[model samples]
Target: MNSVYVDLAIGLVIAFLLFSLLVSGINEGLVRILSIRSKFLWAYLRDMLDGAEGKRSWIPGTIREVFARLPFGNKDARPKFDPLPPPVRSTATTWSGRLYERLREIDHNTSGRTSIAFVPPGRFAVAMMEMTATEGGVPAMLEQLRQDGSPLYGPLKGIWDSAKDDAEAFRKGVEAWFEGEMQRLTVLYRKYVRWVIAALGLVLTLFFSMDSLEYGKAILTDNAVRAQVAATADGGAAALERRLRDKCPEHPSDPYACVTEILASPAFVQIVGNAPVSVRIPDTGDPQWLWNGGDWLNRLVSPAHWPGFLVTFFALMFGAPFWWDILRRLTGIKLRQPDPTP
Candidate 1:
């Protein structure tokens, strides 16, 4: 085997994996800042609450008389309706209060909070089923609510209207409402996530004085460093795989379990065991490079320093699994190539 080329390949793999780990950590941090979980909660409550900001009023309302004493409509419909003296009128409570209460029961953080975004939707839905249940159960009550022009009639009516009142279809439609909202937010989040990656990558490069062009050249030319990095890569990757076997079983998209811990492992310590080379500007060949302020900007877009940082950020936007796949491909190439030794 051509140990030198294989070693250089390993060095590159380790470098990529190192960046992948850093990117994963940054991505997770960005997601936390973006309140990914809370956004879904907001989407859930938006469908249920009235007067929620940014709501589409034209959409049919999903409200129901949540406080009704019986599954049947108007109290006057009962034979013994309102035995009290005449002129005893009262106002009904809005679902917002009860909905908040429902959410607080599951996510205690929702207590005393006015924001609809804090409400946990799945729990609220279950609570509604329990509270509004009848002999025919939640579906039957929903059917009644639909006909009575309850708030739910707006968002869910189309499903029952089109699906011939299929319970599965109604459930799917209700679930889809929240999922669709979340999907839109996801698209926006992805854009912000990329921006966050770029910002974080910039800080990382500056902090470590990392120059990808220099590192690539060093790995190719410094035989001792390349050999050491290759050895580290082979062992470190194997160790990381063993550790990840349980955390990432059968799924590549499950947030790549324990990324921070894996990155801190002894294997990583060994991989970067050598002192880092100093970051330096790559030769531009432009004679006026020293005279121009634009040279700074030029270096950023150059495929060496800041641009390299951007490349790292862009790759990391795909998450750890993606780079791991690339590592595997690189490893495969290393295995297949014939040794160049005499």
Candidate 2:
């Protein structure tokens, strides 16, 4: 019983690590599909640019271009998908960096000494709005700001129009609206990732023929097969990990990246190299052993397969990293401890 339990543990750990990689890929895929980072950046900049007090503002071309690429960049498509963008680095060459350059440009024009990350919302609003303002009151100022016909103007104009005649009210309302949008963005990203994980997990489960339902009978009675799987599991696990070693980001900023990296890793997406190890059981016909009394029991099928599916899916939400962490610790301890069976 103990030996059989050890085999089960070995097989399960390997499965989890592989499956977690699949889940991670699905999560990242969804992020790319939505173009979440670009959308969030646009929302933030839209908030900063809105001013109803006849204030002038400047919108950088670089920032506007990125915004145009937002939410998949296809205005006419029902849902558009884009290739994943590179990670946002703090340097100016990346999307986030370009936005910073624009912020610095704004600060230079306004003679305000503020870092891009911590610029006050109201201060930014005044700078951007007033820059575009011309020699006139609200109507003339709005006309100058809206002249370029940039996509950003639509949202900014909405804020201006909502004021009717109250510039200060419009300013406050714009910031408030932006804050609400920020909150919604967080929730939206989370929900999107979860749905992706669930769908991908199910597909992977089927692809790998991890039909725990089908394997249950053999697992319960076939000691020889389990022993073979356990003995070879470490090698199989190492192979899988090697394939995944460069596939995922080692230290990702969020769940989305972690998942994407796992998915992108070089792995067998099907049951080719991913199947369980098998072994031949000794066929001693002599009834000298009690275990030989019922060889046919190995073929007995369990009707309760849903439990395996449910347990696997639920465990996967913990992600590949969580299981990998434990696997690492166990391996460390295992390396240091003397083998009991030895």
Candidate 3:
């Protein structure tokens, strides 16, 4: 009896693991397609550079202008911005206007690129140096900051004071500051990603009709089905574990390719085949086989199935790496357990 329950739990874990991988893979694809990381980085830089005093409210027009400047997406679709008049362009009086002109200069240097997806610490320090440049160097720059009434004046002054006029020390201080801010930014980005993962999990759960209760009952009641699922999971567990351990961060240029490879792997194929709840299109002569009105309606509105859908959704929200770790532990336990005597 205990062994039967163990088998059922293992089967469920394997199911969740597979589904989580699917959700994660789809999420990775979306991230790449939308250039989410790059956009987030750009937003962070905009806020940082503009400073509190220079910041503008994100009204509809402002939103449109920002959208037009992003480097990603359809270039032709972006709305054109009329060139500023010579006097206005040449004399950027306000601090915000000067910052904008500096960014424009940077963009021009980068072949008219409107947005920068990533900026290394050294490069950021260089940009800052250029932004704060004065004829008399650091002291003059500090005085300029005071005169301009820029919000960053305090922080810049502090950094400069600590550097004590050493150019190398000043650059390093700027780099350190950027690194510290980046750490905080990383945490915020992770939180945003969790919300995205949860949303994708919900969509995948509905699309696949992966009812946890139904799958659990099927595995628990049927000896043959349970045995098959357990066997398949056992066979493929090691391969899947290795695949999960392969870090995509090491291959940022094409992380989506790693996901695509996982989906195409034999282990994933086998596990997905053994999955009890899945969308399948029958090749039979019956034309109505694809459209099951009763099943669709039941899945849509049936309260009994709601709990199952919720279970699957939450399980997937746990993410692929999490379930892979569970799979490893459970597989170890299953192997360690003594087999029943005849």
| Predicted candidate 1 versus true structure: per-residue lDDT over 248-338, tens digit per residue | 4543333234343333333323223222322223235433312233444454456557655555455445656766777788677444677
Q: Rate the local accuracy (lDDT) of all candidates.
A: 0.47, 0.47, 0.59
Residue 136 in candidate 3 has what lDDT?
53
lDDT by residue (119-223, candidate 2, tens digit) is 445644554344334225556645644673334456557877887777786677656655565566567545544555676777665444454433433344345
Descending-lDDT candidate ranking = 3, 2, 1
**Per-residue lDDT of model 3, residues 1-342, tens digit only:** 788778778888888988888878887887666666656665565445444323442211233443344324333221112234223332544453444444443342232323434556766777566655632567776677677665556877889889988887888898888778778778866765676678778877776666787787766645443344445555464543443344445444553444444334333233233332434433445433234445655675778888988988988887777887888887774446676886
TM-score of predicted structure 2: 0.39
The RMSD of every model to the true structure, in order and in angstroms, is 18.3, 18.4, 14.6
Is candidate 1 or 3 superior in TM-score?
Answer: 3
Model 3: lowest-lDDT 10 consecutive positions:
73-82
> Model 3: residues >4 Å from true position, as ranges?
1-3, 52-115, 130-136, 143-150, 222-289, 333-342
Q: Note the clash tally of each candidate.
A: 6, 13, 0
